[model samples]
Every structure is written in structure tokens, then in C-alpha cells.
Target: MIYREYGQTGKKLSVVGFGGMRFGPDEDYGAQVVQRANSLGINYFDTAPFYCNDRSEDIFGKAFKNMPGQYYVSTKSNVGKESTADQVRWRIENSLKRMGIDKINFFHMWCIMDLNQYDRVMAKGGPYEGALKAKEEGLIDHLVFSTHCKGSDIRKIIEDDVFEGVLLGYNVVNHAFRQEGVQAALENKLGIVTMNPLGGGLIPQHQDYFSLLKEREDETVSQAALRFNAAQEGITVVLAGMGTIEEVEENVKIVDHPLTVSKEKVQEIRSKITESMDMLCTACGYCNKCPQKINIPTYMEAYNLSILKDDQETKHRLNWLREQEKIKEDDAKTDACVACGICEELCTQKLPIIERLKEMSLKY
Candidate 1:
């Protein structure tokens, strides 16, 4: 597996880091998996106190017995405004006891997804201060946060210059990083980590976002998805929670290969993807001036993409606006355009906005 820098510490960590959330009642099996992966050269192992209700860290410790100093162990604490210095320190001590390590390579502040979460951590009496104290006392090597919010929220956290690393959801599914603001974060040395690498196992169990590439896909779904992130600049590691030995072997093999999908292949995949898309609206934005002033492109794209999957989560979020009566449940689709003739007049493509929204309405 390729290695990359771990924050400013300059430690060359394996880009395919192992996530310990799956270490469960089968502690011995879990350890075996880690040992096999380590023997093959995966050095970064991440676990957190809250993962699987604290059993994961303990299992990680048991499974990697006597492997101290041979691998990097990363875990996080759920400490916050309510946590005192003593509480935070106690948690770290407990985590060390569970992981069988005196010092952690990366000690992240867990599950921070909003500005308020950051505020709570950076408060005068917050745990973020306690984390800094732990580093001073040699308990932790770095501080980080696993965020699941938009670029707007992430930017707020990066401005603090407080995090040694940033862990966020990055995958081929939601390419939020394509946005200019998200792109800026990569340009800076924030030490990015990708969570939900498989879109929460969508590629393995369900269909990959690039499933349209089946005609030309020379690699496995997981490999294609992983390479997508690893090829991107600023992503040091892509973490995967391997639950079984077979998964460990497959993932390690993928990482051992080149971390890229060829550009020509990428263009072809994009072509198939667009062609497979049932939405022909093309987001021409002819209806830029709506009386309700709804974000036509934003809502419509979300609506079109939602139909691609039968997954409950996708439907739940997609149905949110429709369920709220913003758009009629039946007529509620990106295709549900009244086409008031305003955006149509401005359309350079002369896309039939009203007709397209009408077609979209039929799909939902």
C-alpha cells in the first residue's frame, strides 16, 4: 500500500488505513485480520471510544497484542463542553488501556458535524482545550475531527487552524469537494481523511455510483471507488471498516495497485453515467426566475439522482421536500416545471423547461 504524511508529524502512514469499528465479539478473528494486514504492510489502524459502544477499541487492543510501536493507532473521544479535564484525561487513559497503547498516534475529537459542535469544543471550558493539554502531556500525537457536514461548516473549522487532521465523507457518490470552497480546503495542508469510502458499503452490497462503467470496468467496484479518493490530492488516507478476512485481502490488494483511474476511462465512465441518467433536463437553468424562487437545479438534480437507488436513506431525504408539500408528492420532481415562459425565453439551449419538469413529475 502507498503511504502518505500524517499531518505535520511527517509519519509516512499507509494510505489504506484500517477502521476498527468492526472489531466485535470475535476479537481473536479481528486480531488475525489486523495481523495479516500488518504483515502485508497496513500500518494505520483507527478506532474510537464510541465505535460499537467501546467494544471496538478493546477488541482492537486484544487483536493487536504485542504489536505496539509497529503500527499507528488512532482513536477519538466524545469529550465536549460538559467534559472536565479530569473526564477527558480519564477517557484517554481508558482508551489506552483498551488499545494496549501508552500513546496514540492520532487522537481525534469525535463526531463534529456542525459549527456549534466546534464552538462547544473550542469553548473556554471545552474538551478541545483538554485535547491540547493531552498532547502537551504526551498522551496524544495529534488532534482531529470526523465531520459530516457541508463545506460551509468545514471551512469554519479549518479557519481555527486547530485541527491536525480532518476526517470527512468523500466518495464518487457526492462529489461535494468539486465545489470551489471545498476545493480550497484541499489546496491547504489540512491532512484530509476519507470516511464512508464505499458510500457505506454501497459498492460492495448494492450498486456503485459508477455502476454505469460495468461495460469498461477493469477493476472491482471497491478498487474504482478507493482509487477515486486516493488519486485526489490532499487525501492522505482512505479508511475502510473491514469486517472479514476476505474483505481485508481484497482491499489490501486494491491499494497495492496504482491509485488512479485513467483519464480516458474517466471520461467514458462520465459519458455512460450521463447517458444512463433518466433526467434529460440537463440543468440548462432556463427557469432561473421562478415566482416561488425555488432553486430549480438543486432540487431537480437531487430528485433525479434519488430515483437511481431504492435505498431508504436516499428516498427519505429526497422525499423530504416533497413530503413537506413544497412540491406536490405526486408532481414533486425536478421535471415538475410550470415553465412560466420566463426561464425558457433566456435559455440559450432552448431546453423545454416546462415539458421536462412535467416529465420529471411523472417519475416520482
Candidate 2:
């Protein structure tokens, strides 16, 4: 496995970091998966409190008890949830207890959606103060942030010199949207970790469409996607959510050989991504905070079929979701959206969610 310096922190991190979000119901299995990743030279693991039905930290705790080698664990406290200093300190203590770790290697001010939210996080007696206190107290090693703001806003945040690293949704499909953020991190010599390296499962699900990303014949579309992110100049880690040993092994293979994707090849792949492809919903679930409790992710996922295939395929998907009981009759429909615009405000992709809901209401 290849390692990169995490900013100026003096820590070398594995290029492929384990994201502890997609664990299955079996905690033992999750622990096994994490151990396998560590055994295979994965040294960086990221998890959060509510991941995997709140069992992610427990699984990591189990694995850490018998970890095969040295590792670094990254976790988060959502500023929106734990806004104040006291609340954040409690969150840090709770996370440490859950993970059975004395200190968090990286603790993020999680999910700042825009400059307004960033200001709130940095306000006096706010989340940043709490995290700063934790760092001074030796509870965390480095301070970082995970964000969904645009490249410009990200650049503004980086300019503050408050964080050692930045984690954001970056992938082969959405690189253009976040390119400014990546460049800023590089310029400032900040550690850059990219989440959603698979476009939130979109690229692999439609491998044929994204086949252009593969630089070699043996590379699966997923590996190609992982390689695309790891090959970038500024990316310190390519974070992939691994639930099983197989997934861990598959992702680790991208680092087996040297990542040799050229700027020309990257540009070629970027050119092939059509405008409609840009519109595909990554299903990050940021839009789930709808005031009317509308299932925006599900609807947008179904709408992806309208872009990728046809309206018939979209309707079929909605029907399947209904029959599978993922969408219930009692759930609020798209029409129920009051156009409060909250979902659009929180959306990482800055999609026209209100417009999409209006369109879905009439058509679906």
C-alpha cells in the first residue's frame, strides 16, 4: 500500500482509508472487515457516531481490540447537532468511549453546508471552540472539516487557516464542481480526503457508462474510480466505505500497482462525462432534512433513471421501491413539498431540488 503525508501533521496515511459507514447488521463481520483492511496495510479508518445504525464505532472498537497493526481512526461531531462547546465536548467524550480509543486521530466539524453554517461553527463558544479545547486537552490530534459547500466557499474556509485537512465529496464525476477546493488544499498544503469516490455508487452501478474511467483492461470500473481519486496530486486519502472483506480487498487493489493516471487521460475521462451524467443523484441523503418529511433521495434516485434510461425505467423503479416497502403509502409525496427550499439549501450538489419535486409531482 502507498502512504502519503497528511498535511504537515507528520503522520503518513494509507492512500486508501476505510470509511466505516456501510457496515452490515453483523458487528462481528464488520470487525472482521476492518481487521482485514488493516492486515492488508490500511492504516486510516473513518467512522461517525450514527453510522451503521449506530453500530459502526462499536464494530471498530471490537476490531481495534485486536488490530493487526498500527492504525489511525477518524470520527466526527456534527456541528448542526452539537453546536455549542459543551455539546461538542460531550460528543467527543462519547465517541472516544464508543470507539474505545483514548484520542481521536482526526475529528471533523462535520458537514458544514455553506459559509453561513461555517460562520456558525466558527462562532465564539461554538463547535470550533470545543474542538480546539479538545485538541489542547489531547483528546484529538488534528482539527479538520467535512463540507458540501461549493469550491469558492471551501476556498474561503481554507483561507482561515483553522483546519489541517478538508474532507469533501469528490470523485471522477464531480471533480469539476470541487476542483477549486482541491486546488486550495493543495496550495495551502492541507491534507485532502475525498469521500464519495464512487459518486456514491453511481459509477459502479452504471459501469458501461463510466467505462471511460478505466485506464487498463483489468481494472473494474470501481477500481478505476478509486484510482482516479487516489491518482490526483492533492488527495491524501481516497475514502471508500467498506462493509465486507471482499469490498476492502477490492478497494485496496487500486494501490497494489502504481496509480499512473495522466492529466491527459483524466481530462479525456472528464470530457466524456455528459451533462446528464452530472445530474445523477449520488444519494448522499443530505436532502433528507425536508420540512415536509418528503423522501427526496428516493425520488431523485428514481429520477436518475429518467436521465440514464427512460421514464418507463423510472416508473418501474418507483414501483419496485413501493413493493419493497422502502416507500410507504403514508409517506409524504413530492406534491407535499411546500417549496420551503430547505432541502435545496442543504444539498451538496446544489441540485434544483424544489424544481425536481415540482416536476415529479406533475409527472409521477
Model 1 Cα RMSD, Å? 9.0
Location of the lowest summed lDDT over 10 successive residues in candidate 2: 270-279
Tell me how candidate 2 scores on lDDT.
Answer: 0.90
Instruction: Indicate the residue-level lDDT of 150 in model 1.
Output: 56
Best by lDDT: 2
Error of 1 at 112 (Å): 1.4
**TM-score of each model, in listed order:** 0.73, 0.92
**Predicted candidate 2 versus true structure: per-residue lDDT over 145-213, tens digit per residue:** 999998989999999999999999998877877889999999999999999999889988987778888
Please, what is the whole-model Cα lDDT of each candidate in the order they appear? 0.67, 0.90
Question: How far out, in Å, is residue 241 in model 1?
Answer: 0.8
On residues 129-243, what C-alpha lDDT tens digit does candidate 1 reach at each position? 8778988989898887776555766777777778878777666654433233245456556677777776555455545555643333466777767777787777888888877
TM-score, cand. 2 vs. native: 0.92
Q: Mark the regions of model 2 whose C-alpha exceeds 4 Å error after superposition.
A: 274-278, 322-340, 358-364
